[model samples]
Structure formats: structure tokens, C-alpha cells
Target: MSQPQPERGHMMPRRTFNRWVQNPVLEDYALRYAPKSFRRWSEWTVMNSALGGIAYMADFAIGGSVALTYGFANAITSILVVAAIIFLTGIPIAYYSAKYNIDMDLLTRGAGFGYYGSTLTSLVYASFTFIYFSLEGSVMAQALQEFFHIPLAIGYLICSLIVIPLVMFGMTALSKLQVITQPVWLVLMLGPFIAIAFKDPSAFSHWVQFGGASASGSHFSSLEFGLAAGVTLSLIAQIGEQVDYLRFMPNLSTQNRSKWWLAVMFAGPGWVILGAIKQLGGSLLASWIAPAMGSKAADEPIKMYTQAFHTVIGSGYAALALATFFVLLSQIKINVTNAYSGSLSWSNFFSRIFHSHPGRIVWLFLNVGIALGLMEAGVFGFLNTVLGFYSNLAVAWIGAVVSDLVINKGLLKISPSYIEFKRGHLYNFNPVGFGSMIIAAGVSIAAFFGAFGAVLQAYSPFLSIALAFVLAPVIALVTRGKYYIARENAFEKSDRHHEIHKHSELPNEIICASCEFEYEKVDMLYCPFHKAPICSLCCSLESQCHDMCKAEQSTH
Candidate 1:
């Protein structure tokens, strides 16, 4: 019998693919590696956009809530501790992500979690982005309700819809928005402190000893401290947002290595440093205003900013305007980031599971839709409960990643020196990262339900981190890193070199056989399908080929 030949087509089917990848502007290349050619933005612009994500006023609201529930001392200590941990852990994550042009979802696939293993983490990360998006959007809705008498439902829709257009242009529009809004946000952020410092300095002194709503009336209780830490740890997934922009940082050059490292440090782990300070500021402000506004109102971000505005501009219309300006600016700044990161996360999730990617814009609407649904369901009322519960999963995933980077890579030498994320080279499941995350999450969730008694139960989130960190290295040692990669390198040496070239020197264009679009050489890859290089979008949506290039090596 004659040998059979593979079916041939000039392009992949459009019916099975998404519109976002078909349209470059809408796709934003979220799921795949960020080619050198696409990374044309200056480091300052990328850093500003990443930093803009920190503009979320919810951190203040969270701080205020913790202070009111756990006492000032526990809230302050918890903020500082979580900040330190986030900063230290984020360093390696950001460094690898930028150097390799991979986001956290892709990075996980190489760092011990295999392709499928990391997909679980992608779901966890996607959930984090949307959950927080809903929380932050709810705050914006409340502000709208107070200022304009807009119904909460309508405000929620407005808040969710506004971010879609901003994200449509992807990094291009995002970078500009972040840079323009940064100065204004800083001024408004600092204005309140300046007013308080000058107008009623004694108010700060009174706030220092305020124990808030704690029955114990002391900040140093171990139980309260543990509970507070659980709530604060929920923000651990934020490193995912930092990595989104870090992937676009200009490659390190001999002349600019120092500046490059500085930018990464300041924009990466350094975000938590600023976050902790803001949390503390919020705690103090909330305590000072609690008496006048009533305890419930004081814990709300809107009221906290409103009081600060009153301190400076005095009561009535002027105060309301200042308050509204601060709230609106802060919301826009953070929500853009929330929506952007959420879209990337959803892209990561659906692409791997379904073996198809529609484009980042499709996921943008999907993320916003999920968030909007949560808002309509009244997510704000369950904020503490939701955050506390989510902390367990967030800590496990982060801890596993950190353990692989710090311990598996550093101490055990089990992980690769560089991140290997191309679909052609990774295992479907690496026991080290996958095992550790599962074990840690399992134990922590048990403790969270009082399985280990009140103290351990209260500190379950912290326990999850510690357990995952210890377990990741142990799993790597046991497995001997056999499952980390399916194949060492699939691309030819010449192709590898082509992948690393700077955008200007590389050929300006190539035609994707699948989509029939002319893209830059950097945007196209040599696919075995159609016997030509195709755009990453086409590669993602090309289900007919069934990844024939890696089929032999694929664990799946």
C-alpha cells in the first residue's frame, strides 16, 4: 500500500478560531510569548502602566476593614508582613518573566508545573483578577451612587464597560493612559495626608492607640494577627499583573543593565512597599474619621476620601468635588489594570483547555461580564469572606512558583536555569510544582475550616505558603526534574537566533498562510503546518494540525 500524506491547506479554518487573533489590535498577543519586535515601548511607559495598577483604592478599603475588625496593631503588622513576602517573592517572578518575555501563566508551565498543571493555576489567577475586578468596580459603583444618584446596577455596568475600550488597543493604549494619569493620581493620593498634617495634626496622635472594633482592645493578639494575615495574603496573585508589563521591558543590554534592573525592582516587588504604606495611611485615616461618620461608613473607601477632602476643602460641595475626583481617578487607574490582566488570564485559561484562542478582546468582555455579574449579586457584602477563602488558593500557587524559583532553581538545581515555555518543549504535568500546590492548598483549606484548631485555622493562608515552599523542593528532589521538559529544543539553531533579533534588524514582514495577513517576521513562527511560518494567532487556532510538530514528544 502507498504511504498516506497529511491533508493540506493554505490557511487554518476561520470558523474554529476567534476574531481577536484575526485582528492584531484586539488580540494583544496575551497567551503567547512576547516577541522582541512587539516590545517597542520604553521601559518607563511599561513601568508606569504596571504601577498604575496599584492605584486601586480597595487596598485602602481592605486596610480599613482589617483595622476595624482586628485592631490597629494586627492590621498594621499583617500589612507589613504580607508586603515583605510579596516583595521578596515577586523579584524572581518578575525577573524571569521580563527576561524571557513570558507571563506568569507561561512561566508556570516551565517552572515545574507542566502545560496542563499550569492550566489549573491559570484558572486560579483568572478567578483572582475578576474577583478583585468586581470588588474594585463595586467601589466605583458606590461612588457613582453617592455623587450622581446613579443606581448601583447602572453604575456597575458603566464601570465594567468603560475599561473595554481602553483595553481594546492593548498595551499601546494602556501605556499612554497609565502615564497621563500617574501624576494626577499621585497628587490626589497625597493631598489628603498633607491636609490632615497641617489642619489637625493631633488627629494622628489620637489614631495611634485606637484599637477599633476588637473586643480585646489590643493590637497584639495572636489570633487577630493570624486572621488579619489571611485577609492580606489574598493579594498575593498581584504578581501576575506586574509580570504582564514586565514581559515588555526592553531586553537587558550591557549599557542599560543597571537601569533595567532598577526598573524591574521598583516596578516589580517594590509595588508592595508602596502598597503597605498606603494601607497604613488608610488605617490611620479610617480611625480618625470613624467617630464622625459612624464605624460602618469609616471603613468604606468613599467615606475615607470624603473625610480627607473635607479636611482640606471644608464641608459641602467643594469637599464632594474633591472626593469624587479622587475616587474617579483612582478607580479608572486600577480598573484598567484589572480588566487588562483579567483578559490575559482568561486567554491563558481558554487557549490551553480548548486548544483555541479567540483573542484577548473576547476574553476582556468575558472577564468584565463575570465581574459585572458578581457586582449585581452584591459581592461587596461578602468581601472579607471571599478574600479570606481565596487566600488559601492564592498562597499555594504563589508559594509553589516561589519555591521552584528560589529553592528548586537555587538550592536543588532541579529546575532549568532559564525558563523554557515554548509549547514544543514542556511536559504535560511536572510533579514538583503540581504536587506541591495541590498538597499545600489541600492542607490549608482543611486548617481554614478549623481542622487544626483556632490558631492554625486563623493562620491557614500563611501555613499554605510555608507548606508549598517546603514541598516544592521536596517534590523536585524526588522526581529528579524528569518531567520539567518534554523535549530540550525543537526549533533549529537558525530559527532560535531569528527569535532573538531586535525588531528593526529583522525582516519587516511575512505572510501567514493560515490568516493570509502580512505580519512582521517577529510576529510569525515557522510552523510545520502548511510548511511555512505563521502568526502566533494562527498557530494557536490551528486545530487541524494537532500540534504535529510536538505530537511525538507531547505527554498529552
Candidate 2:
């Protein structure tokens, strides 16, 4: 076995260090580059895991609320518009993330946000996770309250606890969980629509013209359109959730080229296609159940599903049971993803700000705890308000990223060809993305508050997207992309393997420099700390070294 080399700083002994590095399941090591050895899943498996996140009940709830408030025509039209936008923006971003094996945070840094500029984006993305986490958990809590007569507080605890163990395992365990539960969840999800179609064959016609409860009826109102757009736009950040799994896609090759592209295309922008459908379904069900459960209960996902199931199943007891089952399965599928992605966002946030990452698992718990608290405090009541406000920021951030990638990287040569995310090789802020986002957010928020009166206010979300998209390229052209990359890559001469680890390993073992642990070559990197190969986890948590070795290297 390769032995540990001595370093000047205080260090843990080899055995103790090995224990710390042993946690591959919990510590997927979000802060470091993903090594080839660690990315062993097949393309199909990775795609499945990515698709699993789409099982969230929020789609149903959002759809239901829109249908109940705006009626069928506006809800369907808004969904189609949002779906097209999400698809176009998601494609290139997903392709790049899979091609590079990096997360959205890393992708944002290279796209034009700069190093720390993307850190703000991370906070935005993290907020998406927690907010959605609370929403999904609340859905689960409602199911528990209906099925088991559990108190809402106890339901919230149960909903939060179930996802922790699943997230702790990271991608490996998450992939299996998704695959195993997907078929059941899908059947349950589609069951209602199928039953509605059969039971009331003419329901579709009635649904098509339904204009909701608005004062204007089926006629379009600019204020109503803007309000609907804002609610729909909150889903813009879901692209980050897709990239979390896209990073694990197998490298494209000649033999697997078709499958590779298909996986990327379907798993990436394809998510919104399903999302729009779910939203429409929610709207329809909310409309159907509003009379029985009242308008307030119509927006609740569990209640919506329960009424839909009751229409087909006939037996009230069986209907409640099936509805609870579907709700539970759907919440578990989505909350695990929420917790997992939140951990990655938090890991990126603290590592840059504090220059320390305890581990992804630590942040995983912290993120879940925050969501749990929100669920207990009643997240459902504020759902529309929260989502509408957040949509402005979300649209602005995504608009900046997409504009820079398509314009700055494709048309202009200002930004670097690849993403450079490491702290050592990036400016603290880049005016291009940051400035575009600020202007977009500020203007849209002002409009949302009716600064230009009710007519312009409803269209604030669209304004945010347009302003950011237009501003990003202009800012990049003016700045000439000077701040995009701080340094050229110093390790350009190294092969892929060498870039990941400093030393080629013997069959059996290698040594870690930071913590002085000995392990299989798979676990080690040629870190300069002890002048030997160090395990990946130890290298991730090492705060003192200041990235002395790869100072000039770019990260995404």
C-alpha cells in the first residue's frame, strides 16, 4: 500500500482519516470535481433518477389553483407558454452540465455569473429547494392527516423524517428508490385523468372553456394573465434539479451517441412537458372538487386527488386509501430530490463564503430541518404569495444564464469556452450576469407592485425574463468578457485521469495527503498536502491549502 507522507499542518492518523473518508453514500462531495470512478451508473439509471424529481405534488397544487382561480383557458394557455420557455432554456444548460459532469452552480459561474456572482444564484436555487420542500412536505402531511387521523405536527415530522435516510445515500440510493417507486406513482398520478375521461366523457369540453372565477369570466384580462405567469414562472429553477442528475450521465461516445443525446434531451428540457400536463390536471381537479370541499380545499393536492379517486372508485373508504397512497408515494419521490439538491446548493454556498464544507450530509439535514419548520408553520397558506414573488428572481437568474450561454459563448467570444468555478480563478463578481439580474429583478418587482398600474403589473414575470435576456448580452459586449475568467488553466497538459488525481495508482492502495490515510487508488487524489495521493473527501474539506496546486485551473 502507498503510505501517507508527512505534512506541516496538524493531521488525523491514517485509521481515523479512513473512517471520515469512508462515507461515499453520504458524502458525494459536491464541492470537488466528479471523478470518473465515482460516476459508475448507466445512462438509463441516471435519467430515471432525474425524472423521479418530477413526481412532486406541487405541480398538481399549482395546476389546481390556476384552474380554480383563472379557469381552463388561461391555465392551459399559461402552461403551454411556460413549458415552451422552460424547454428552450433547459436544453443547452442540460447538455453542457452532462458534458462537463458539473452541477448548476458550477455551470452558472462559467455561463457569465463569474465565481461569487453565481454564489448568489446558489442562494436563489437553495431557496427554491426549501420552498418546494415545504410545499411537498405539506402535501404529505395533509395525506397523513386524512388517512391516519394524525395531528398536522406529527404528520410534518413523518414527512420530513422519511426523506433524510434516502438523501443520505446520495445518488446511489436515490436512483434505486426512484426506479422502484416510479411505476406505482405514475399509475396513481394518471389514474384520475383516465377515470375522469371515462366517467364524464364530456368533462373535457366543459373544462376547455372554463374561465374560472375571475370577474371577467372567459375573457382575458392583462392583470390576470400577469398573475398567472408569475405563479407558473416559479418553476424556472427546476432546471437546477434536472442538472443535479445530468452531471452523472455517461460521457457521450460514438457507440452510445444516440442514447446519450436522447437521454439528455428527454431528461433535460423534457421535464417541463410533463410538468405542464400535471399543472393542467391540477387545475381541472381543483375545479371539479371546489363545490364539495370549498375553494380553500380545492388547491390542496391531497384533497384534489381524493375527489378524483372517489369519482372512479365509488367507495369512499377505498378512495381515501388510494388517494393517501398516491400522495405518500409522490411526496417521497419529490422530497428526497428536494433534500438532496438543497444540500448541494448549501454546500456550494458555505464553501465559498466560509471556505469550508463540513460535508454534503451536514447541509442535507440543515436544509431538511428548515423545510420541516416551514411545513409546521403552515406553508400552504402562503404558497401563492411566495411563489409569485420568487418567480421574478428565478426568471431573471435563468434569463441571464441562458442569454450568456447562447449569446456570449456562442455568438461573442467574450466569456471563456468552459465554466471556471473554483474560488482561486474567478472574480468575486461579474457585472454581466449580476447587473442583468439586478435590473431585471428590480424592474419586474416594481411592475409586480403595480408601479405602472394593474395592467402592466400582471406581466411582470415576462418582463423579468425579457429584460434579463436583453441585458446579459449587452453587458457582456460592453465588458468584453474581461471578468469571466481570472486565470488560464495550469493543468492543460495533464490527461483526464491525471487532472482528477495526481498519481496513477497501483492495483491495491494509495495514500491521502491531508489526513494521511491509506486507501485504494479509487479513493485518493495526488494532493500536494503531504506530497502524496490523498483521498477525495479529505481534499474537499481541507480549508488551509488555498488551492495552491490548481490555482490557475477552471472548475465547471
Candidate 3:
């Protein structure tokens, strides 16, 4: 049953792409390795761009909404608890992605999920982008409605369309945009807090006791705390967007080790620290304005900050204008990232299923168009219901990935130490990670719908995390790690047992036989079907070959 070896001298016909796919600046290596040469930005610039997306106003709304529902003690306790978990889980994922220069989708492919297995996660990630895009866009529209007396429907279109040009250029434009606005953003973000603290120092004392609509009042309730935490846990997928930028980090070296680590830690998971603070601050402002603006109005950042600035600035019109300006700036900064990351996720998903890529630009419009529709449909009106339901799925996906990194690879040493993402090298399915996520998400979603009980329903997201974390390593052990790799890598044929880490030590450039383009050696795989070397992207887009390389290898 053994198959014949590939003909050594034969070459298959090559494939071609349009100008958009060929351009490095616009494409930004959407579905392949971000080679060392393309990662030309300094550590500081990359870190800033990665952190820019954290400026979203959704935190403000989420915090205010949760606090208004669950009271002060439960809301504050839940935010801190979820922030700690997010910070801890973010570290290893961020470190590995930066070290290997692969985006989250590629990392999922090699970490434990096999080639096609990660398509589900890609869809999950793409959903995160558009859902949050709609949420953030809704915040911007609310600001426009308040300031200009415009209809929410028209404002939605304006908010969604403005970021298209800014994000079309990919990292090249995003880097500059993030760096230029960061300083002003920091000042504007903190100004209201400082003014509120100095003007009415006693406001903090009153904030602790003001309960909007919670049955528990100022006291904590475990059930209410769990519900609040579930809403905040939906932010777990924000790390994927962080990894999209972290993949552009330059190779780690002794000279830049300290700077690199700092950037990764802060820009990666450290985002939650600021995010948690913004949430608590939003809670505080919501309390201050609830008496005047009513409970529902308190959740809107535009309304919350406008009243906060009234204490600092004398003119009512000036305060409204400043708050409007801040909201627009924050939304533009984050929506660009949302739109950009969504495009990358959709590209990863469809390119695998269809074996064709029109380019990242085509997906960008699709992602934005979906978000625009959601915004017009008023996605923000049902914020708590939407996010609580989504947290079950998001937490499960993250939990499975983290378990693979920290347990299977680092502890048990069952999975490959280095990432192996090339299509030719990976199997189509691996139950270790993908199966764990499906089981966990399914169980937790059932609990969310009260399959277990009221307490478990309130804490369904925790169940998802626990199940995924425990299941990944157990499944890997039971499967005997057979599904991790389909065949020994063929590119380093001098030693059939060579590890992929050695590929990074080899020469950088190799011209792919399928595309006739020079790609880094790490992204190129030996193709048995073509009897030549091929780049990962080119290999992914190949449909006629039917993965003949892995098929031939498995026969042995």
C-alpha cells in the first residue's frame, strides 16, 4: 500500500494573484508567517498600535450596565476577578505569538488544533470582531445623536464608513494612527477623572452606596457577581486582536529582550488593566450622573462623560463638544482595528474552506458591511443579553488554546515545542484542542440556558473555562498524540527527524515553486504533488493537489 515518492525534477504550474495580494503593505501577510524582514517597526511602535484598540468605549457601557443591574459590590468584584484571569491567560498566548511571528489563527493551527480544525475558531474570532464593531459603532452613533440631534440610523452609517480608508492600508497606516493619537487620548481619557476627584472629593464616598436597580442594593450576592463576571469575560477574545499586531514584533534577541518582553506583556494582556480601570471609572461616573440623566442614560459614555466634564468646564456647550470629540476619536481608533482584524479572520476561514483568496481587502468590506447591518438593527440595545450568551463560547475557545500552550506543550511535552503551521505538514483534524472547545462550549451554553440550575446558569462561563482547561490535556493523553503531526517534515530532508525550530536557523529566502515568489524558509514546505517547494499561502490555495503530500507520507 506504500505510495510512490514524488518525482524529484518535475515542477507543477504556478498560481498568480492580483496586485492587491502581491503588495506587502496592504496584504500584511494576512494568512502566512510575518517574516522577519517585513517586521521593520520598532518595538515601541508595534506595542502602541497593538494597544490602540483598547480605547473602545464598550468597556464604559459594559461596566455601567453591569453595575446598574448587579449593584456596586458585585460589579466591582466581578470586574477585578475577570481582569486577573484575562491577564494571566494572555501571557503565554502573547509570548508564543510574538516569538514565532504568527497570528492567532496560525497559532491555533499548530498549538493543538490541526489545519482544518481551526476553521471553527476562525469563525468564532471573526464574530468577535464584528460584534464588537457593532457595539463600538453604536457608541459613536449615540454621541452623534446627542450632539447633532441626528437620527441613530443615519449616525450608524457614518460611524461604520469613516474607518474604511484608515484601515485599508493595514499596519502601515495603523502604526502611525495609534502613535499620533496615543498622547492626546491619554490626556482626554484621564481629564474627567482628575476633575471629578478634585472638585468633589466626597463623590467617591457616595458612589459606593448608590444602587441603580439591583435587588441586592449595596451588598454583594454571589449569583449577581457571577452574572456580572460572565458579561466581562466576553472580552477574552480581545487578546486575538492583540496577537494580530504582536505577530509583527521583531525576532527576540539578547539586546532587545527586556524591551520586547515589556511590550508584549503590556500591550498584550496588560490591556485589561486599563480596561478594568475604565470599567470602574464608568461605574463611578454612571453613579454620579444617574440622579440627573436617569438609569438608562447612564450607560452611554457620551452622556456619562458630558456630565463629568460639566464640573470641569464652565460652558455647557463646550463640555458637550469635548465629550463628542473624545467619543469620535476613541471610536475611530478602535473600529479601524475591529475592521482590520475581522478581515484577517474571514480570510483565514474562507481560504481554507474554498481554497481561494481574492485578497484581504475583499473580506474587509464583508466584515464592515455585516457590522453596519447589526448597528442599524440596534445591537447595542440588547448588550447584556448578547455578551452574556457570547461569553460561553469565547471563554471556551480561549481556555482550550491556553491549556494546549501551558499544559500539553510546556508541561506534558506531548505537542510540538515549536509551532508547525504549514498546510502540507499538519493534519486536517486534531481532537486535542478542537474537540475540547466544542464539548466545553456546548455544555456551558446548555448551562446558560438553565440545563443545570440557576447558580450554574449564572456561572456558565466558568464551567466552559474549567471544562476546556481540563479536557485538552486529557484528550491529548488518550489519543496518544498521534493526531499532532501527520508526517515528518520533508523540507529538512538531510535528517528526517529534524525539528521545525531548525528551519528558522536556515537561510531566510526560498522561491516557492507554486507562486514563484520568494518567501522565508519557515513558510515554505516541500510539496510532493508538485515535486517542488511551495509557500504556505500558495499551498493553502491549492485545491487540485488534494493534500497528496500528507497522503503519501501516511502510507509509510
Candidate number of the best TM-score: 3
Question: Using alpha carbons, what is the TM-score of model 2?
Answer: 0.89
lDDT for model 2 comes to 0.80
TM values, all candidates: 0.91, 0.89, 0.96
Best by lDDT: 3
Q: Give the per-residue lDDT digits (tens) of candidate 1, residues 95-134.
A: 8887877789988988889877898898899899889999
- Write one digit per residue (lDDT tens) for candidate 2, span 1-556: 4554545344545424233124766777576555555778888888888999899999989987877777666777787888899999998899878877778998887787876788889999999999999999999999999999999999999999888988988998999999998898888889889999999766677666666787666566656766877899899999999999988877666677899888888889999988998998888787777767888888898898887888888988899999998999999999999999999999888877775666788889899999988988898888777898899999999999999888888788677666665554566688899889989999999988889778768888899999999999999888888778665433332333223333323334555555554544434455444455565445545567677645524452
In order, what lDDT does every prediction score?
A: 0.81, 0.80, 0.90
The count of backbone overlaps in candidate 1 is 0
lDDT of 3 by residue, 1-556 (tens): 2122334455555589988899989898999989877889989999999998889999999999988888899899999999999999999999989988899999999878899999999999999999999999999999999999889999999998899898889999999999999889889999989998999877787789966688889789999999999999999999999999999987777678899999999999999999999999988888888888888888999998898788889689999999999999999999999999999999999999999999999999999999999999889989988999999999998999999999999999999777888888899999999999999999999999999999999999999999999999999999988888887666655532123333434344777777888876678788877777778998899998898888888788
Better of 1 and 2 by lDDT: 1
Please give the lDDT score at residue 204 for candidate 1: 79
**Which candidate do you rate higher for lDDT, 1 or 3?**
3
Candidate 2 RMSD computed on C-alpha atoms after optimal superposition onto the true structure: 4.4
Candidate 2 pairs with clashing backbones: 63-283, 64-282, 64-283, 71-212, 226-458, 512-534
- Worst 10 contiguous positions by lDDT, candidate 2: 489-498
Query: How would you order the candidates by TM-score, starting with the best?
Result: 3, 1, 2
Query: Lowest summed-lDDT stretch of 10 residues in model 3?
Result: 495-504
